[model samples]
Target: MFAFASLLALAASAAALQVTQPSNSSGWTTSGPNTVTWSSVSTDNSNFSIVLNNQNTYPQYNEVLEALIQTSEGSVAVNPPSGGWVAGTGYRVNFVKNSQDLSSLLAQSDDFTIEQSSSSTFSAVPLLRPARPRPLVPCQSPQPAPPPLRRLARESASNTDSSAGSSASSASGSSSSTNAAPGLNVQTGVYGLLALLGIALA
Candidate 1:
């Protein structure tokens, strides 16, 4: 009975060890454009360092822009320490371009996926939280409005006619000015004669 009890205790401890094994292996899949989901064999106790495997394809020099952890509970954004991944949880890391001007990245797509190095370790991945819906307000009824046909037609026709007339007038003005070249040539000749006389006197 003592030997049996000792064997049972050893078996229980081994089972516990297996259950508590650290997730050192990592895997990834593209969720959508600009989003990726990373799954680990185990949860992370310390901050995980994820490097972009294909930086050459992305606009940013790095493929690992950020890491996101999603679990049964909720999701969190992981970046630099103040914005890094939460320790002791499974996470989905997303790589994206860093945009300083826009509120969000212009393009979002995982160029390529990366796996955790054999030396790396982590815990279980956390679940993402659902976003709260916005409250709806009662909309006011609209008043009756006049028909827009006349107003729209008048505005459009007037703009078109004015533009056509302006263009025609400009063309005519250009032609008339171009036709007055002989007068300009006479002026040029007079100026040339005066210049020659001045030069002779000098």
Candidate 2:
């Protein structure tokens, strides 16, 4: 019975040392510095350090970010090396207790994967803007269409032309008769008189 009680108490104390940040199996992007959070213990010691590590290789744990001195923050903000974390690679975070004596190692978070989004890489770049088009100027003055010819005007012109043509024909005939030879006209008159005298004699 005493052994069972001791086992339960030991389990509770181990659970108390677990770090809650970067909660079990979480992921982080490498586009910028990551803000990792964990549950803080209210111990007398304020000294604590947090580290991020690449746990992908066998039998070797590579350090990704430098050990960070935690602020009043129960969380630590860390930026990986300039090259950044590897995509699809797994990582681990350890929250270590700092002390002169044998410092108790705090709990470690579960494996978290590092990944990058398509937009994340170019997020810091400026966007290009489209150019403005020039405004078009309209015609200041438009030309007016010419007026149409009326029916009465057409009829009037036709009548004037007919009158002018008839007058011209009559004047031409009269001019030809007047220009005949005087001898030819006198012979015509003498022949008409002789015919009249012969009819009277009969």
Best by lDDT: 2
Candidate 2's C-alpha runs over 4 A off are: 1-8, 11-17, 64-68, 97-104, 121-202
TM-score of each: 0.26, 0.46
Clashes by residue pair, model 2: 21-37, 21-38
Q: Which ten residues in a row have the lowest lDDT in candidate 1?
A: 15-24
lDDT for 172 in candidate 1 is 96
lDDT scores for all predictions? Answer: 0.43, 0.65
Per-residue lDDT of candidate 2, residues 1-202 (tens digit) = 9999999889666645455556445677766676676554454235556656565677655443434355346666677666665576667776566432213456567787777755465346687888889899887887776556786688889999999999999999888777766768899999999999999999
lDDT of 1 by residue, 10-119 (tens): 86544321111112343332221222233222332222223333334335333354332222222233233333222322333322223222222222223323333343
lDDT of prediction 1: 0.43
Candidate 1 accuracy as TM-score: 0.26
